[model samples]
Target: MEHIVNMKSLTTEEMMKIIELAREMKADGIRKLDRTYYVSNLFFEPSTRTKSSFEMAERRLGMEVIPFAPESSSTLKGESLYDTVKTFEAIGLDLVVIRHPRDKYYEQLVDHMDIPLINGGDGSGQHPTQSLLDIFTIYEHFGQFEGLNVTIAGDISHSRVAKSNAESLKRLGANVTFVCPEEWAGEFDYTTDLDAQIENCDVLMLLRVQHERHDGEGLAFSKWEYHRQFGLTLERAERLQKHAIIMHPAPVNRGVEIADELIESPQSKILTQVENGVYVRAAIIKLLLKGRNE
Candidate 1:
């Protein structure tokens, strides 16, 4: 079965096709898809954008959805993701949208199931769909990713959104940069190995860290100081390429990673990203649920 766990897992053509389909679906009307489907949202962590978007996407397509929250579901029974996936399989689920707080979180489930799996996110390391919708959403504004300068600032080592965006931008030849401190930088961090990857970048994306997501105060640095060093200050954000865009996956820490002013600025594509997320997810479901036996 096919799965979407990361951006690098898809060819450029495949990625574009999905985004194009999303736009087409948005233009036409979601109710036009003829199918009865059930999608399982197996989110092990808290998420509003991803959860609600996927839910609405399914509804717009005239499909049914089953959701799992840590507090409201059998996950509280200490069910493993493996077992949960099996249960969904037994129930005849068409697809599963999964997320967790571990890096490469879906690696273990890749071969365990027969249905297509759409990875909502795996920890902070690879939210592939978010990055895809991000590019598609930006295209509505800038036309294409070429020559776009996208700077990703914040927890470079952990942000799957940042990781996937860096690769997506690079694959499309957009200049991408990592703006985190040296202590948390890496080859995949978009800073050290990809200096040439960022020059003349056309967009700057910021990632915010939640207090609960951090291990302890000594893990890296205090939240106040993290903001001081790498957070996207208004001045720093303005220094980007003139037409550069600002994007963030929400639940932002105001005044911490991203200044509130920039989030509300015209240059920010944050809200559009959230909106496109629904369309993209609906498109993904169309792909996976199509040709299924009624």
Candidate 2:
């Protein structure tokens, strides 16, 4: 519980504790912390949801958020990640949340820092908080994870969401499946067909096709073709089970990962996932700060 770095390192009890706490906070509004603490967010990549969600979470807990922008900071002058973090620690900040483009970027900081570090994201590596919120959203709907069939579809090779959720969902006793183009499957076993998974899955979790990570390479298929083949078209949406839910770790390419019409569909939990992120993150901060005091 020292660093909220990755899902693989968390025990089932710890994950459940965070989820339950998030649910409680969602039911009863967040209560401010007894003492104000200071935090900073260091995002080296562009973000909307995670950055804003963490800010909302910190404010809800009555924590002071120190604003930081890398372009304006010492990083432009070649300050190392470790050096930057040390600077923040020297400033007496209580905690830090970081999202960097490099994978496992927190590794170097974790051993050297005294303050807790919450990873917002690392390059296609892990997004533990996003995974927790996603888990919280699913639990909110179904009341459990055991034996649930979760199908994760899209850019598996480049999605931190897919990686984090796949490991966590399996650990929590859910049967997990990956659907993606063969080249995008990465190290996981996967099926190319989304249709076959539609009827059985309790959660159809779609990931954005991370074109930014493709290193200037062009997609083999056009958007229409990708949508027809892999995206959740209205035709395919008809096949989902009665109790099944649709999800996306979005910044959704409306016609790419899923149809535009389904974004607000009755079965879609995309917006709920975003809303739950605030409470889930608040719970994480509360627990981590509480753990620090003890």
Candidate 3:
């Protein structure tokens, strides 16, 4: 069975194939999978877009989805994650999509389970599916990843999306730049000037300020200060290249990562990203299932 733990697990060809499949799926508006598999969604962290989109994808593909609620389930009663996953396997669930708050948490479960394990988001580790959908969205607009100037701004250290995207985009031939405060910048091609990046980038991807993951000492700057320094304000949006676009993995920290008006602007591809997520996830599940059969 094939488990999508991170973007690194996938080759460039494989990523391209998945994006092609996603595009095909979107254009056809049809689910082409056999619909014989059952999948479980085990999310230990809170989510709005990824969780719902995955469920919608499963439903569209005609697969049985067993949503796992860790809060109310045996996990609350102190059942181990391993045990909870094992129980699902025992109940005949064919695969598991997990979102946890620990880095590389999926690694621990993949070997212990018989079914395929998909990483939804493993706490500040990697969000491969998000990156896949992001690439699909970028492709839909820009037609290709090669030579595209893509800027990822804000909260880099705690962003799984940024980590996965930087790796995948670079591999796909996009010039990836990370823009953030010095503390958050970690061994990347980084810049502190958001305006300079916006002027040059074909795609400007903004990440939310991950206050949830902060150690209280980091991101010490005020929201207004952060906005002044790095946020995608109206002024910055106006200066974007004629063909440039903005993107965010939602649950946006409104004024921190981007202004509310900018999110609804003509240059914003945020909603498109959400919509493409469903198709991309559907394609991923179908491909994984096909791999199992082959």
Q: What TM-score goes with each of the models?
A: 0.88, 0.99, 0.96
Evaluated against the true structure, the overall lDDT of model 2 is 0.94
Candidate 2 clash pair list: none
Q: Model 1: what TM-score?
A: 0.88
Model 3: per-residue Cα lDDT over 42-117, one tens digit each: 9999999999999999889888888678878989888888888899999998778999899998776877777888
Q: Supply every candidate's count of residue pairs whose N, Cα or C atoms clash at under 3 angstroms.
A: 12, 0, 0
lDDT of 1 by residue, 57-123 (tens): 9888877787666787676888877888988989988888898887787888887878889899887
lDDT of 3: 0.89
**lDDT by residue for model 2 over 6-122, one digit each (tens)?**
998799999999999998999999999999999999999999999999999999999999999998999999889999999999999999999999999988889898888999999
Task: State each model's CA lDDT, in order.
Answer: 0.76, 0.94, 0.89
Better of 1 and 3 by TM-score: 3
| Stretches of candidate 2 exceeding 4 Å from the true structure | none
Q: After superposition, how far is residue 111 of candidate 1 from its true place, in Å?
A: 2.1
Candidate 2, residue 138: lDDT = 95
